[model samples]
Target: MAKASRRKSQSFLHGALILTASVLIVKLIGALFKVPLTWVITEDGLGYFNTAYNFYGPIYSLATAGFPIAISRLVSESCTRGAYRDIRRIHRASAPIFIGTGTVGFALMVFGAAAYARIIGNESALPALYTLAPAILFSCLTAIYRGYYEGLRNMYPTAISEIIEALSKLTVGLSAACLILHRGMKEYEALGTVFGVAAASRDYARSAVLPYAAAGAILGVTVGSALSFLFLFCRHRLLGDGITEENLKNSPPPRSMRKTVSRLVRTAVPIGVGAMAVNVAAMVDTTFLQTRIHNVMEQNPQVLLSMYQGMIPQINIEAHTVPNFLFGCFSMALTLFMLVPAVTQAFGISALPNVTAAYTRGEKTHLKKSMEAVLRVTALFSIPAGMGLAVMAGPVARLVFGARPSLPITSHVLVIMGVGAIFASFSTPVNSMLQAVGRVDLPVKLLAVGLTIKVALNYFLVGIPQINVLGAGAGTLACYFFLTVAALTCLCRETGILPDFLSIFGKPLIASILCCAAAWSARGLLSHVLTENLSTLGGVGAAVLVYSLSLLCLRAICRDDILMLPNGQKIAKILEKHGWIR
Candidate 1:
């Protein structure tokens, strides 16, 4: 029993580590896709791509987000009670819901594409929206299995599917974008037109080709989602979730399908609403940021232009595409800012089942320990990463994206967004824990207030000539800061368990400060002797070394945290011999 308990506990961190490792690979592949695609289609084209995605976000959340989490939590609770038969029933009951919602989401994206594009004031985004619509259905299908396996504390299927999707995007999406651009340019050169549209000049022809190129790139995402769903479907059939006939015979009778579906809806609605609030905030950002920036451009073009002075492209200004162009630059910064949260999101997903199991069993001590470990791990990662990005925003941007003309704007936005990433990253795991402990509606309320704050701030700030695009970053920082603090407070109150705040947050804060200082000092020193990219790399290396050492010296991580890893017991013994951990 003790050995079985240990194995169960290990599954949480082991699963988190699996998903985290996969996230790193997927993000690396994403960089390969987005960075080169940015060059192929330019920042303006990326704006169209992201605009379509922004619209997709809320609808996708509405369709698929809550149910998987609902399923995961329900499955975890059922597993804790040894209801293997009910687990099978839960999977069976989820099918119709997923199929129904996915179909509706796909239809909405397709039929609403033109209207959404016009509302966002960028008609060029329509084709990308249409191409990306099918992903909604496929992603919903994929989510069903991901949530089910995650509830069982299995991360392999989700991780594998994500990698398959990312690889598809990198290979198929990038190739398609490049092919479209090349063919369009070649046609312009040969026949003085691009795709049957006569152009006044080569540049004009390229401009005309961008919307189609962005759509072609998005087509890869649609294809990848479909392929990922197929893989999940195949895997489920072959492996069969490890439930045995004996287990099923011993388990209690399964709930009625109607009862199970009702329970699922009761659990999913609040969670889905919270998820939708977050995505709607993204949609708000998309709508308000562009509209406000367009307002600034129309009312005070010279003031906004003068702020960036020679950085804003003449072609963009002349075509009145400065809004989309600036949005594209902001998106570039967002691409990097999101990586921190993406990594921590794995922690949230993995934590749900473990925390759920402990809480359901009324293991108060175990629950507290699990909560602290999740928080501590989240802090140890998010704090330093956010700080490092803030400290090295410029060099990192220049390194990843090359010295594009937009670096000035992109780097500036990244500085603010890097700070925001810390709060955003921490919020995910905190909310998951809250849901696990049965306060599922708190996240929705908190997110609603936070989204209001964000929208109001962006509406006012982005319209300011000087703050135009930077305002979006500022709004994000403000929104997440409030959400993180409030969510953590609510978690404590609901769980009636105040975790070791100092150990969870304080030590990591000190370590992260040192890490950022080391990065900054190292970068400043190395810049005098080395090239910019090399110096940035050196600074990052220094930060990692310092952060690792600081964690050991401060003992920010505990033995249980270490024990969560593969070979963790042996590693803990080594650290204990050296008195590096307690």
Candidate 2:
């Protein structure tokens, strides 16, 4: 039994590691892809691009975000009982529901694109919204297969599909945006629409190109989702055959379709509502920020136009600039979104099997230990990752977005958002654990409370002339901080599974602080000898090395902690051979 338990634990860790690595790779590619994209589309175009996404965010969440976890949870529980037939029933019932939601979402976006743009105070974003509408449908369908695979503890399909999605988005999105920028610009110039014209006409042409670029970039989202859906569908077909064959041979009775659908919905809706709260917050940011800006400008075209006057021609500020600029400023917060999948994916994927299994067996002690291990792993990576991002925000932003005049502001935003990212990382797992234990509604309630705080803060802060975009970042930080605290508190009270603060967070905190100091010092020293970017690169490289070494030397990373990684055994062997560990 002990050996079996050890193997099960290792299997869980292995799955977490695979998903974590895959998510990290996907985020890196997505970030890199955004670099040339920002250059090609410029910040103004990015603003519109973000505006479209802001509108799409809630609808997409409504369509697909909650079902995966719910499906995974239900499927994991069924698998734990070895009720294989229920897995087939779950999928059969889930398909129509997911398909219906996706269809409704797609139709709503297509039909309401103009109104959404108007509501967001960015009429120019209409085309981009239209371009992104199809992605909702594709992504929803993809989530079904992903959820199924995850339930089966198979993460490779999701990983491969994600890579394929990212690559496709990068390739198609960049190519399309570049094509519009170069070729499309020449056409406008040829028609004397924007080029070699008076300032007014030139301004008109500049504004005209932004929507096209935004739409082109958004097209990648649609294409990428479709490709991902295709890949997942094929993989699921090939890999799911064994399970299907077994179900056929066993000929186990299936549940009623109505009951299956009802159960899945009952489980999924709360998760969906909670997940949608994040999207709702994002939508609120977009709408409130733009409308408030428009109101502040008093809806006067000239006043709006003058805001962009005296802009550095090389830096590309425009009349309709603030909304896009504000969007671009806050868009850097997406980097925080990237760091989340590392902690969240690991915990979220494993939560179903580990947390659910323990809960089902009424093994509170096992559950406590499991929760502690997961929390330790979460802090092991998330704290350092968040702190590292904050410490190196400038170089990271410049390296990713290029050294533009706005890099400083964007980097500053990243720092603030990086802190929020840590909170979000914690919040995700807590919420997942909550759902895993069948308390799905609590997250939705907590998220609602957080959203209220976020919206209030954003309204008050974002409207300030001086605070503007930076205020949005502050509000976001506060929002997730609230949710994280609330969820962590709730998780402990409900499950009595309090993790060791010292081991889980204290050591990581100390080590990360040391790592940050080392990295900061290295950056300062290298700045004198190298260019800013190169110095930053060197500093960050130093930080990673320093953090790893410090963790080992401080004994913050124990043998068990090392062993939980996918390559933990090999890593432990090497460490022992070098006298790094005994």
Candidate 3:
């Protein structure tokens, strides 16, 4: 019985890990496209984009009511009740409802574009405003479909479809952004006057040029949306076909659509609200960061328009979002969205009953052993990984973002975010543990408190003279670090084991110090050996190798620790069918 349970647990963990990896790949690819697309559109537009999206996002999230998760919960319930066909039926019914809601959301974005632009005090924003409208609707459809698929007794198709959608969206968005930028000054001026530029453009002694300029912006919008929809809809068709072909034909029908949706909506309301609340906390940062900046610069458009502006777009408002959105969002949020939380929750859910059963039978030792294993493993991964990110901060940014004209601000912001990145990674598993044990409110409350601190800090820090966003970055680090400590404290209190914090700190601290020194020293020699920025890959390569060797030499983590490391010996052993040790 114990062996069977252990196998089941391992299977769940393995599956979750695979799904997480796929999601991360998809997210990273999407980001690869989206970031450049954004950069192209916004020399100064990132701040503008941030203003609109910050307010628009909460509404967008609310419109979906987090339907995907709702669907998952419903599907799980229906499956247990032997109502598979009913699950499909519910989604079929809900599809149009989601679309209709999305239409309203789309309309709100489109019609409200001018108002939003005016609200942000930039007439130039009108074009981008209308352009993003289609995304809202497409995203809405994606959410509903994801929810339905997750609830349908499998998640691989959903995961694959997301990858498809992300790849397609990124390709389309980036191509359009690049084309618009490459066309040069004419397009740049045209973008500036997208909505109302015609009036200002009329002063252009050549009034005939107005029409062509206007057309470019309009064409950019139409094509981008058309491509996104094309990709998403195609993915949907392929997924639907795959489902029917794989096992649905042989499977029984799901249960009543109404009942399934109702139950789902009930659970999803809180979950959706939880998700929205978390986003709103971010919105608070977004709303305040720029305001603080504007207060200091006195809204100097010239200063705001500097080439360095790209370094601190509204996208970089929190000091953390840019770094996270660029890369870490996937590894931490997208991948762990399924892996750490889902797997941990599965473990907790499965174990809770076992613990209860064991305790009833007076098996204290079994309970202690079980609880200790969970805490220890969670600490082992979460602690070291967070430290690794914090340590590798500057070098990773250098390697990933490169030394652009804007590298100074971008790199600095990224390093500052490094601490928060670690906290985010560590806290995820802790929150998952909370969720695993059915303590949903705990995480919501935690996020709420963290957000409060974030807001207060961003408000105070974003305007600290030239410190500007650097202080905001500090605020971000503080929020997550505080949250991690709180979560760790709570975990210890709940489980009765104080993690060896001193030892946990030892590995990451040493590893990061070594990495920083290696990167710094490497920098001195690197400039002499190679042309500036030409040696990006080489510099980063040497630095990473040194960091790894230092860690091993210091015995920070055993050879057994690496499962996903490149050229991992243990992985080779398993793949080659050698007797393996974990």
Q: For each candidate, how many residue pairs have backbone atoms clashing (under 3 Å)?
A: 0, 0, 8
Decreasing lDDT order of the candidates: 1, 2, 3
The sequence of per-residue lDDT tens digits that candidate 3 reaches over residues 134-171 is: 66676677676656544443445555655666665566
TM-score of each model, in listed order? 0.98, 0.91, 0.67
Which stretches in model 3 have alpha-carbon errors above 4 Å?
Answer: 1-13, 27-42, 74-97, 111-116, 150-155, 181-259, 299-405, 427-433, 487-517, 534-536, 546-582
Best by TM-score: 1
Q: RMSD, each candidate, Å?
A: 2.7, 4.3, 8.5
TM value for model 3: 0.67
lDDT of the structure predicted as candidate 1: 0.90
Better of 1 and 3 by lDDT: 1
Q: How many backbone clashes does candidate 1 have?
A: 0
Better of 1 and 3 by TM-score: 1
Model 1, residue pairs in steric clash: none
TM-score of 2: 0.91
Compute the lDDT of residue 530 as modeled in candidate 3.
80
Better of 2 and 3 by lDDT: 2
